[model samples]
Target: MYVYDEHDRQIAAERVAQFRDQTERALAGELSEDEFLPLRLQNGLYVQRLAPMLRIAVPYGMLRSEQLRRLARVTRDYDKGYAHFTTRQNVQLNWPALEDVPDILAELAEVEMHANQTSGNCIRNTTTDQFSGVQVDEVADPRPYCEIIRQWSTFHPEFAFLPRKFKVAVNASEKTDRAAIQVHDIGLQMVRNDQGELGFRVHVGGGLGRTPMVGPVIREFLPELDLLTYLEAVLRVYNRYGRRDNKFKARIKILVKALTPEGFAEKVEAEWSHIKDSPTRLTREAIERIQGYFTEPAYDALENATELLASQRFDNRQFDQWLSHNVDSHKKPGYAIVTLTMKKTGTPPGDVSDTQLEQIAELAEQYSFGEVRVTHQQNVVLADVRQDQLFELWQSIEPMGFATANLNTLTDVICCPGGDYCALANAKSIPVAESIQRRFDDKDFLYDLGDIDLNISGCMNACGHHHVGNIGVLGVDKKGAEFYQVSLGGSSHHDATIGKILGPSFAQEDMPDVIAKIIDVYVDNRKEEEPFLETYRRIGIEPFKERVYA
Candidate 1:
C-alpha cells in the first residue's frame, strides 16, 4: 500500500478546506444548485434518487486497516450503517445529508482518504488488479504506475473538465486482465520486450454504455520512462477533439471511432514527439521512488503450506470449495490471496455494514499485513494471507457473510445500485440481482455451472459493467414499465467481448427464468466441463438465444 507523503497529506487537507467553503456557501443559498453542481460532483457527491450519495475513492482499490476503520466510522455517523461498494473500486454512502458531506470528507482526510476525482467529467480513479503485487501471474506490479497516474491526475488543471469522464486501467498480468483494460478510456498493459525491459502496450477508445467497444492497441510498446509523457499526449488529443456538443457522444471512444485507432495513434504520436523528453517524462529515480512504496510485506520464513492446506481440504468439503473459489496463488509459496466475497445472498452484491467493515479491518491487520484491497468485482482482497492460516481465516469470515465461496461464479454477480438509489436508473437492479441470486442460491449448482459472470446495470451507463458479463442483464423502461434485457457470451477477461442480446426484453418477473434457460442451453451444449463463456463461444449464441426465447 502506498502511504501518503507530506505533499499528499497537504493537498488532501487543502481540498477539504476548499470543498468545505463551497458546501457552506451552497447550504446557505449563497451558491445556487447550478453553481454548486460541478463543485459537489468534483468532490464525489451525487444527488441521487432519494438522498445525497458521496462516493469515496479507494484509489486502485487499496486500503489500510486504519483507513477501513475510518470508513466504518463515517458510515456509522454520517449515513446509513452500510455503504455500497461500486464497480469503479470505490465506496458510496447513499444517505448522507447535504450539510454533513464536508464534515464527512474532512473526517475521511484524517485517514489519508478523500472523495476527490471520484466523479464528474474528469479522470476518475485509476484502477488495476487487486492482486497486483502478490499475484503469481503478474510480469510486474502495476500499482506504482497507477500511483504515479493517481498523483498526476488528482487535480490537473488542463484536463480537469474534459467533455466526459475518463477512466484508465493498468495491468501487468500476462495471462489475465483483472483490470478489464480493454473497456477503459485508456488501457496500459505492461509487457517485456525481447530485451526483457518492461513497458506498456497501450490501448485506447474502449468503453461500454450506449456504445460498447473493445479499444484498439494504439502503441505496441511504449518504454517505461515515457509513461507520463505518452499519457499526456493521449489526454491532450482527447481533451482537444472529443465531442462536447452531446453528452452521449462526448466519450474518447467516439473520437477513437471517428478518427480511427491508427489516425488517433498518429495524432498522439505527433503530440508525443514534442514533449517526450520533457520533465514530465518519468526518470529512473522517480520510478524507483514509487516502486519502493509498494515493497512486499515482510513475509515469514515458512515452508509451502500445500500439505497442510490439502489436509484441511480433505477434512472439510466447504473449506475445499472456498479454497478453490476464493483463494488465489500468491507470488510467495507460503502465502495466498483471499477474496472476501461481498456477493452473499440477500445482500446487494457489495454492501458492507459498519460492523463488517470493522471486523474485516481487524482480520486484515491480523492475517494480511494490515492491508486490504477493494476489487472491481465488488469484493475485498486480503492479498497476503499465509496458506497455513487459510482455514482459520475462512472460518472467521464466513459468519461475517464475506466468505461466500462464489468468486467468479454466477452467484458472485457484479451489480450496481440501480433505480433503488440512482435517479438515472429506469428500473431497480437490487431486486433483479436478488431474484437471480435466489434462483441459483444452491452452491452445488453454481459450482457445477463453473465460472460465469452475471452482471446487472440499472441503465445504459453500465455501472455494473453488464455488457461484459457472461450473462448480462440491463434494466430498461418500456413505456413506463420496467423490463429486463439479457445478453449472452459477454466477457471482460482475456480477449474481451461485448455480449449480444438474446431477443425481446422480458418483464421483471421473468428474468430468472430467462437466465435459467440461458444456463440450460449452456449445460446442454457444453463440451465436458467447459465454462459458460467457452460453451457460449463454441455453440454460438443461437442455441442460448433460442432456448432463452423458447
Candidate 2:
C-alpha cells in the first residue's frame, strides 16, 4: 500500500544501473567467480546446483497488482516459467541466467521492487504480520515501523556486511505472533506502557539455523523515539564483539549465547547511553512522515456479509470448508482476509506458474484494491476481500489451483525447494511435503485433526522455518542417503517453542507414515476440541515419539 516516493524511484533506478555494469563486467570475464561472489550476493544472486537463483525482495510482503504482473513477466521472460515464494516473503527465480539478472533487477526497479540486501550478510527484508493493518485485535499497524526500518537498513554503510545475516520482525498484535518475532535477530513488539505511551519491547539474538534459540527480552520498553538509536546501539555492540573467527559461530545469536541475555542487554544499554539522544533518534515529524504512507484506503460503506456468506456456506460444502480455513476476521466489518493457498499436492509449495501469477495479479486488482500480501506460510493474502464476494473470489482462484481449504491443516505445509533446486539441501523437501499431502488427502480427516503447522526445511538453515512448526520435518543426510528427521510440538505463536527430534531419522519413503503416526497419537489422545498443538503439549512428545518410532 505504500507507494514509492520519487526519492525511492531514483535510488532503485541508480542501483540497477550500477548492477547492470557489474553484471556486464562479470559476464565478460573481467571479474572471476570469487571476485563476483560477494558482488552478486549483495544483489541477491546465488549460484545453485542447476543455475543461478535470484531472490526478489517483497518489502514486508506487500505488492501491488502492477508489481505482481511485473514479477510474472520476469518469470516468463528471464528465468523459468515459474518462481518460488519464500518464507521470508520473497520470491526466488531458480533458473535465472547470470547475464539476465541485471535486466530482471531493472524490471523490478520499474515497480519499486528490487533484490537488494536479500542476501550477503546485511539485514534482510523487514517482515511483519501479513494482516498488519487489517487484523481484528491488532494493537497497532506494524508496517509503518517495518517500512521505516526497511528504508534505514536498505544500504546502511556501516552494516553493509556483518558477522552474519540478520533479520528483524515486528509484531503489533499480542493475540497472534504471526511474524514469529521471537525467532528473529531483532524482534520488536509494539506495546503501550502503564502511562499509555506507545513503545517497543525489544527481543534480541533469536534465530534458527545451525544453532536454534529464541530471543530474550533486551528492553522491556524502549520509547518509540529511541527505536533507531537503540537498534544502532544493539548493532554496534554486535558488530564490535560478535565472533568473526568462525563462520558457524558468527551470528549474533552465538554472541548472545556467550554473553547471556543479561550481559547482552547490559552491553547494548552501555552502548545506547552514549547515543540515546543522538540525532539518529526518530523525531515525531519523521515518524508521522513514514506513517502517512500507510494510511487506510477509502473503504466502502457496505454491510457485513454474515447472512449471505452463511447461506453460501450452507449451500456449498466445499466453499464452506475453504471459508473456515482460509478466511480471517477483518477490522472492518464487511471485509475479510483470505489466504490463497499455495500448498497444493505434487507441485512444490510456494510455487506459481507465469499464467497463475498473471491471474493472481488480475484477481488482486479486481477484488482487493490491486493489492496482495505474500504470507510467511507460503500463501498470498487478499487482505481487503469483501465478505460478500467470498464465493466468487474462491471460484476465480480455485480453477487456478489456489483454493485449497487447508490453511493451517497438515496439507498447508511450509516447505523449501530442497534438493530439487538448492545445492545445500540434504534431501528433497517438496516430495516429502507432497507425500504427506497425498496421504492426508481426506478432507474430513484433516479438518477434524484441527489447526496444525507442518513445516519442512531441506537442511539446518531452516529456510522453511521448520523449527517453529507444530510438526517440523528436516531432511537429513545419513550415510550418503537422504533421510528425514521429525520434530514435534514446535510452534510459532504466542507461546512459541522449538521442536524436539523424535529419535533416528527414517528413509524418505517412511516420512508420510511417520507423520501419520504422530497425528494418530494426537487424534487418539486429544481432548474435545483441543488443537493438535495443545494435545501434543499436554501429552508431551513421548507418546508421539513412541508411536512414531514404533
Candidate 2 stretches with Cα past 4 Å from truth are none
Q: After superposition on all CA atoms, what RMSD does each candidate show versus the true structure?
A: 0.9, 1.0
> Over the stretch 1-550, how does candidate 2's per-residue lDDT look in tens digits?
6789899899999999998988899889998988888888989999897999999999899999888889899999997799899998999999989888988999989888899999998899999899999998877889989988998888999998899899999999978888899899999999999999999999999888888889989899999999999999999999999988898999999999999999999999999999999988899999999889888887888889889998999999999999999999999989999999998788789999998889989998889988999988989999999988899999888879999999989999999999999989999899999999999999999999988999999999999889999989899998899998888888877688899887888898998889889888988999999998889878888998788767
Screening candidate 1 with a backbone cut-off below 3 angstroms (N, C-alpha, C), the clashing residue pairs are none
| Winner by lDDT | 1
Per model, how many backbone clashes are there?
A: 0, 0
TM-score of 1: 0.99
**Span of ten consecutive residues with least summed lDDT in model 1:** 541-550
lDDT of 1 by residue, 1-550 (tens): 7888899899989999999999989989999999999999999999999999999999899999999899899999988899988888999999999989989999999999999989999999999999898888798989999999998898999899999999999998989899999999999999999999989999999999999999889999999999999999999999999999999999999999999999999999999999999999999999999999999889998778888998999999999999999998888989999999998889999999999999999999999999999999999999999999999999998889988898898888899999999999989999999998999988999888898999999899999999999889999999999998988888898689999988889999998888888888888888888888988888887887667666
- Model 2: worst 10 consecutive residues (lDDT sum): 541-550
